[model samples]
Target: MEKQDVTANEENDLDDVANSSTGNLVDWDGADDLAKPMNWPNTRKAKNIVVICYLTFLTPLGSTMFAPAIADVMGTFHSWDPLLASFVVSVWVLGYFFGPLFLGPCSELYGRLPVYLICNVLFMAFNIACAVAPNLSALIVFRFLAGTFGGCPITIGAGTFGDLIKPENRGKIIAVWSLGPLMGPILGPIAGGYVGQSIGWRWICWILAIASGVGAVASFICQEETYPAVLLERKVRRLKKETGNENLRTALNVDRKASHVFGRSIIRPLRMLFLSPIVGSLSLYQGFVYGYLYLLFTTFPLVFQNRYHFNTGTIGLTYLGMGVGSLIGLGVGGVVSDRLLTKLSARSGEKKPEYRLPPLIPSCFFLPIGLFWYGWAAQANAHWIVPILGTVCIGIGVNMVMMCVATYLIDAHPSFEASATAASTATRSLIGALVPLAGRSMYEKLGLGWGNSLLGFMALAMCPLPWVFWKYGERIRTSPRFQMKL
Candidate 1:
């Protein structure tokens, strides 16, 4: 009797311990589980969002801040060939082509935080290399290295948003997030012009390095781990520790081989781009938008200096028109997207990805309008303000459309949002790098009127994209492949 009682007591103790160990379980109890990022406190989510925004801001700021200093760099290096001078910026753009395809996949293998922070460190270090370079070749190599890592933030960022915010509540957050990239082209040159003119071109690189150092430190401290699978894996490890159960596992369990991780990262973006018509079409359109943006960065100086007779300092200020438009895009686009999502969700009795797309419609038509007006006004040498109006319209329309596609994609593929974003980014970055080469020649040969009109016609051809997706997206999404495999 005594032996049996002792065994019974042992069993009861084991049961109690098991009950107490529930907190450490690898799986979330339900959708309401606080461990899930979507259920994290508002304050906690805000911290992540703010840190991510700062990181995103650093990229575009670094890319274009050196623009006004380009001439000075060439003069200092005694570079007689204009193309070689342009190569400094072009090499950095080349990094944009490669970073997304690699880094985006790596984010899935490692957690978002680790991948982002590591890239930030490398990017900053390369900026220092750029600052102290002994020759033009050295500077070009460093700039390329910096850009290769610098693009990690924007590439991996859409996944972080999907991890934190539900589709219904994502619009305002996305708009705020987008402001960094849009405004960078505006603020960067403004600061770069004055600093480059007053101090020297080298200071532009030094200043960016310093700013990135601050960003890296802040990210290390404030940005929490956001990848859902990563969080679940952590829970699995913790549960194993607590329960002394070696078999504890989560759905995230997978091989961690560097080769396998890398191969998938390389191949997945290609698969998504080639296999999914939705991703391909949207990405191609986005490519045009991104390419156009870079073109503006390169071409604007020529336009303002030649047409408006603006000096460097004044030429930089011309970007402010687009800056204001960025703010408007954030405000107007966010409101319209959120309102549409809310209304559509209520009507359908379930929120669908299609809800994220209605706002894209307006932007589609408006872009060509801006392009044509901008072409004609700049062609006729109309008041500088007239061309500026076209810029504002372009800023708002392009960003609104961009915002819609990114958010819609997140909703469309929660499991592979990072990879999907990478695929889209690859197309866009490739165009951004290649198109600027043509932009100057195009404007010179065709003149602003016909050159921009050509771009406008291209924009018009792509306008059907939003409507097709808005109408048929559900059917496309329901295809066996995306729904099942992802």
Candidate 2:
């Protein structure tokens, strides 16, 4: 009888411990639960990453693939204003600025897979519309819609990385993933130059449409829901149905109304953007870099064609210098980032996000130097290779900065990686869309030497930002004033 009583007491104690651990909420079955993305087999994670990376690469490729065809587009539409031509390329990026504001939040509420699938379908449909656009107005409208849908991968990609990969192991994966956004635009103009010069600009849209269609099909087959909250919520629903218990709830669903949750989800990214010091500062720097890249894209044709007397097909080749530099940056940055993070974490006995910023400090200097070199070299009508080499430096700096900052944001935010990335993406896309409008006028008034020198000066002023953040980032991130309540 005493043994039976003791067994009962022991069982009751075990039950109490379990309840306390879970707080009566549903969650992963265990640390090794296969349903958790982080616990999935390596092969499954790699497959998902490949699909996500391809979509990211394709969307940004669409953003600039038509850039080389801009003059032809204007000629076809019979529009003479240079500003209008610039607008034609930039309006698509403007869509990028707005899409993430809603999409990121929605993904948090629903699931990553659903958002990706819906956006893929819509993106494909809009690209087809762009291919069949009857006028410049129609084309611009179609482009904006396509861009908005195309931004799905950009907004949620880092968050997905956060879902599947541990912080220590993320740098290498992120470096590989980042090649999409950085290289897509670089390769776009090259492909566009030849495509536009040979077949016509309309084919560019058709090509994107076909690629998006294929991507949509592959995503449906491969992509799975990785968001923890959504997964737990699904499990809660299943359990409730099986046990006939109305009280079953996931932690995320506890005492929360649908409307309230939806409203908060929509506002979270904006809240983080304006209220968080780290997000704002890093985003500002990223915005400047992204804007500079687009500015170069808009002006490259004018420089290469008019100054160097290159044809359309040849003008596309100039982007190769930047592309080569980006490849170099990607390779070096990936290897160094993980090794540095590991070394620093080992030495400090803690993994902090600041470890990611060290490479960024020296990399930032390359931007101004490249700008100065390219500007002065072009202004003097030096060898075409001179300006091209300058772009290589710019590419290296840009890639390293982007890779580092993105990894930092993901590491710092923990569960809120998607919103943080959305905030960053929104800021950069806005700048990217607006800054190029001034490029033509700036280059026209100041000339290449002074114009690029001016940009270089601004870049030089911001070079110390990485050091400042590395020193104080943890304090700012932890402070109540900067923390997002969501």
Candidate 3:
């Protein structure tokens, strides 16, 4: 009888362990589970995506929109050092570096919407602070705080993509979402340059604060909790309350001390960044690329003002090339990614995460071409349209590559998509924050031709990154950590 009890206890323990993993959780009602976001109506899902994309758009917009106004801010602050002026821009990104380390995991514990709305409110309030700041120091400090709040969407938005869309269809859906971030930064300069040129530098912050207030309203009124685990947990809570059965639970979570769970949740993004090779490799690759994009933001004004003799407002117009390229990339990457998956799945009778990579291959090559072309063309003082053409290519390439990398990470680790994206965002943010400090110096020393050529070489070196993952990604996914336990 003692032996029988031991065996039964072992079985119970096994059951508890199984329950701790995802498959055993209180899942959606099979195919018709209204609770499952995947089953949400196309219109409802569209609304959720639109809000999420708008949220995504706001952060980069806030970061880059001020680029055109950097000189004005510098003059107002009474500084001539470009790097010191850039500190205002770079410091905000520094917040991006840390927010994801914790916020991404927090989204997992809480739901995406609460975290998003709260962060958006904080971001908007800090923008108001920045507008009214008395000194350069105060402005820098407020920008960092605003960035901390604004950083939420970039990290969490990828997880939003994972939540609402399936792997196969995610490409096109993701492309649509990609438009916001890509367009926002380009658009920021276009508007900000004119605003800073005409009205004043401080209004840069005022305008963003007003626009963000609108976004915050849409967020609170329209968005819903999209995290599946969180939704299931809510269902479990409702069932427990309704039936008076305390034992009712979900497979997504085990009954553990809240403290223990919270501790793990807090450290998960860091752990993913440090320990997971999949997350780390892609983070490093994309980080460098993202950093270059920011560096370009700093350089565009100098390049146009010095090389082409364009005024500030018209210099902002040059960014339209990149904006248009991003839209094209969105369509191309989205349609191709979805179609490729559909066709490949049809052939193999199933879909695999590795299939997410083909769209990125073109990006690798296009980036270098744009780099080399823009560098030499601007150096030669070719027609103004020539360098703009090169920028268009870079825009399309970078957008497609980034969207694919994000989708690949999401597909590889669906359970930990938020943490995975956090890892990627963490590196990207850190690199972006640090690299622009050197952008002015690099352009000054190398001139437009060699400076961009150097960047092009970096892009060429990174070309192998997507290919390496595409070839061996399945093997990497086989590691114990990436797999969902049965």
Q: TM-score for all predictions?
A: 0.92, 0.93, 0.90
Clashing pairs in 1: none
| Candidate 1 lDDT by residue in tens digits, 1-486 | 435643554444334335545533355545765657887779889888988899888888887777767788888888866556556665676787799867876787788998888998998899999989998888888988898898888888888888899777888888888777678767888888788888987888899999999889988888989887788777666556756887666654566577887877778777888888888899899988888877878778778888889876677787877787778888888898889889988998988888888878877777788889888999999999999899888888778877888888777877677677888888887887778878877988899999999999999999999999999999988889765544
Instruction: Evaluate model 1: give its lDDT.
Output: 0.80
How far residue 166's Cα lies from its native spot in candidate 2, in Å, is 1.0
Q: Candidates' lDDT values, in order?
A: 0.80, 0.87, 0.80
Error of 1 at 198 (Å): 1.3
Best by lDDT: 2
Q: After superposition, how far is residue 283 of candidate 1 from its true place, in Å?
A: 0.3
Candidate 2 residues 351-445, lDDT tens each?
99999999999988988999999999999999999999999999998999899999999899886777788888989999999999999999999
* Shift in Å, residue 133, candidate 1: 1.7
- Clashing pairs for model 3 are 25-251
Candidate with maximal TM-score? 2
What is candidate 1's CA lDDT for residue 110? 84
